[model samples]
Target: MKLAAQRLIAVALAVGLVSCTDDPPPAPKPTGLNAGTGCPEFAGSGRQIEFGGEIDAELGGVVLGAGSTGVVLAHMAGGDVCQWLPYGQQLADRGYRVLAFDFAGSGVSRGHGVPLGRQVEAAAGALRADGASRIVLAGGSMGGAAVLAAAPTLSPAPVAVVALSPPTGYQDADAAAAAPKITVPVLYGAGELETSFAESARQMYAATPSTTQRQLVLVPTSAHGVNLLNPETGSVELRDRVTQFLDSYAPPA
Candidate 1:
């Protein structure tokens, strides 16, 4: 009887041990988690900073990086600053101060507020007010069109523009009409399999005035927005190429 009890006890111990072996997941890294390299300190949601101000715009956003060059990341329609959180942090790590915001009627932002173009322009202005002498505007999808619309309105003008999966015509913003007005270098891209989106990119590139230096690339992958930048989708070189493109025009942060 004692042997039987001992066997049962051993089985219970084994089960307990197995259950205890399950480890919890690693803690989430803070916003602007650095690459172990020298990166700027980013004040995230806790900061409660408001940068967007077109129509009483109390739009919320995070500011990362302290480099001379600045970048504004515009999220796709129906999305907000959170969409660009990871990307903004990495760009900050790479020496560029990055600002991403929620437009009115999106995310934490409220009110009918201003148009997309005005919202993006306000964001770039806020970046300058924060002390970024040089700026680069970047976005995806509807957000791409927003940056394109804002580019022509910048005072000193953004050093360059990067648009991914930007549509040709979306509501009020017209990429064809705005393309010729882009005064700085531009890098536009889209997924080859995205049909209309890919065609939209081509149209924008062609409409871009011959006077401006512009280039377009079609990724073989069908991912949209920054997803087209994924290396796993055979676009391994896309990210580095973008960095190189910015380095040439904006000269890095």
Candidate 2:
């Protein structure tokens, strides 16, 4: 009987340890932006901000507009916050607060080694800290996979997600595995001519369980990732469709 009791206690301790390790680390405090040099010139009246992680890496970010519904824009691999600036400003003009941030080792952000999904989660916390009551995550390429993986586990969960040209997996984030677990509305888009990314979009959309809230859109061009939204190089129809989707599932007001 004593041996059985000891085994049970050991099992209980093991379970407790697993649970503690599974819980996400607490959100980091904002550390100010660009070391007080102010936001980039293109930010245009946006406020500069920063958030840190366990390794003391500080991510650079820009915030625009004012509202309870905030939109967090994550950029592509090798890209920075500038990649999302134009679209983010548009979302801000529509009454949604917007946050465009640089992941660790990208752009003005410092530090390395943090997982992509964790960086995304930290960005969401930064938006909430900036006074947003709700969140909508949007990303391009590698950023798209990161948001998809993070969405399933984010505290408070995002109200919606927009993924463009995302791969099934990018580094540490796996959108394919995360898709089935996402319960919120999601807009998946890619260029039809960009075969692999387009196929990934389709697979993820098909895998998502929310039949009524998931959408897949493929444009005619070969543009990939954020280029699909570029004013001069992208598809007008795709841009219009995204606007419509946001209005339907995540109205700014």
| RMSD (CA, Å), each prediction | 12.6, 17.1
- Per-residue lDDT of 193 in model 2: 96
C-alpha lDDT score of every prediction, in listed order: 0.77, 0.88
Residue lDDT tens for model 1, 1-253: 9999999999999999888888676897654321111112333421334765445666666787778899988888877766676677778888887887777777766557377887888888888888799899999898888889888887878899999999985667676689988879998888888988999999999989888989898877778886766555536556777778988898655
Q: Each model's TM-score?
A: 0.79, 0.83
Report the Cα lDDT for candidate 1: 0.77
Residue 183, candidate 2: Cα error in Å is 0.8
Best by lDDT: 2
TM-score of 2: 0.83
Candidate 2, superposed: residue stretches over 4 Å from native: 1-41, 54-56, 210-212
